[model samples]
Target: MAGARFITLFVILSSACKVNSQSSLLEQFVSADTTNRAARFAYLKKVSPTDTICLNDIKRAIRDSSGDSALFVFNVDGFSTMLRYENELAQICKSNQLKFKLDIGTDIGYVDQTTGCYQDYLDLILFEKYGKNFKPDLHKEANDLYLANHLLDTISSWDCDIRPRCLSANTHTSISIVVDLPIKAHRKEWVVDKKPMFAVYHPFMDLSVVIDKDGNTSGYQLVDFIPARRQNKKYKEQLLAIAIQEIKNKYYKWKPAEINGVLLNTTHVMRLEFEAAAISK
Candidate 1:
């Protein structure tokens, strides 16, 4: 009788353990949305008010998540307004040497065929004026853009080598920020756009993007953002130095991994530094 009771207890305990494991995985994969209201609310309470755009509201309705990282996924609407604010953010991350990934949507939103810029305001005009009968062709164009940019993997594959020996890894290490910018698509304006022109172009910033020991996506965090200038170049050097110092200090057991049976102890640090002029557009 005692043996039977022991077996029954073991079965119950195992079942509970399995449930707990599954719950944890769900939490990891789940997007930041209302379905996880309790967790989302708790997270917002912890964010600093100083973070340029207050993410408190969006936290409740996020469709994507960056694990425990407090990510802010801005769309074209927010991108327009955040232009002034984003530079500051880039500076902070650069100063702190924080490893982050910047994900940008490749194609989406209202695009101008002539200027290669998306006239995002057109959407508002169409909705207010023509309602559903508004330009279906334009709507289709925007839908196509969204579908093109929705693929997350493509954005994560950029080789942003602004600094020397930076971003030399194959694993996933990224931070994504989507912005809506007008692409100059007018035939007259087309002459001005350089190579690989788009009706609407999204800027992506990848900071400290590197692979992990387990052959998975992992990167170090650079502070937040730094100023955009010659001085920022020095800041990149300093940030990289600090990151290397920290890795040596903590995560002691973390050893460099071999890629293709070849060990690459490359002292490469991922960095993001760009001109305010380039990003402002």
Candidate 2:
């Protein structure tokens, strides 16, 4: 009786594994034909009844090896259908207690030319905010950074009644310019100890500066100073001091940002690259 029971259990497990393998393969076929709703539904019906296959079950079967599921909906479908599908997936995630995120890929078409232009304008503005050292990866955190600085409200209130103008004559051409960051100097022009020198190492110095309504620097703080190369403890301090003095000697100006014709306290980031130059006798 014991031997017969073991054989029954083994047979049941083998059949279960075979079914799971076939289900997984079927899910791959469905995922590959994302744009073909009719095909996918037919395959689902072949596996099980349409009424029995819920969104959650589809999510489970088609989930990648990392245990994450992604659904790609084509824009060829009307906006209503796209939204409806998204809502269904969202409902499934909530009911199943699953973490979900939605990313719209480049394949999605813009509603109009104006919408595309508006997106480009926003990108340009963000580029001005980060200056010449803008990193594309930092765009993900831009919203949080803008919110922390209370800039969103200020930007929304900008006077679109006419072409915007700077608050002062010294205002920079870039709308979101930093007023205290050093300009890029030619290597030949960079001098130390009153002698022309070549830079052996250069690194970026990250700083934040506050600008008042008058386009003047109110305060400055260093967030980080990356050294070009490692140095002795004493030399490091000396190099840092030199970098500080160099930045302090530079001048910066930006169009004072205003909201509804009222000047607001504004803070901007400055990324200064400091080079360690050595003069050869």
Best by lDDT: 2
* TM-scores of the models, in the order given: 0.19, 0.30
Kindly report which residue stretches of model 1 are placed more than 4 angstroms away from their true locations once superposed.
1-125, 132-144, 147-207, 210-242, 245-281
Question: For residue 140, what is the lDDT in candidate 2?
Answer: 17
Which candidate tops TM-score? 2
- Segments in model 2 whose C-alpha atoms lie over 4 Å from true places: 1-200, 232-244, 258-262
Per-candidate RMSD, Å: 25.3, 21.7
lDDT of each: 0.30, 0.35
> What tens-digit string does per-residue lDDT give for candidate 1 at 18-78?
3113222112212111122333234334444443222422332242332333332222221
RMSD of 2: 21.7
Return the clash pairs for model 2, or none: none
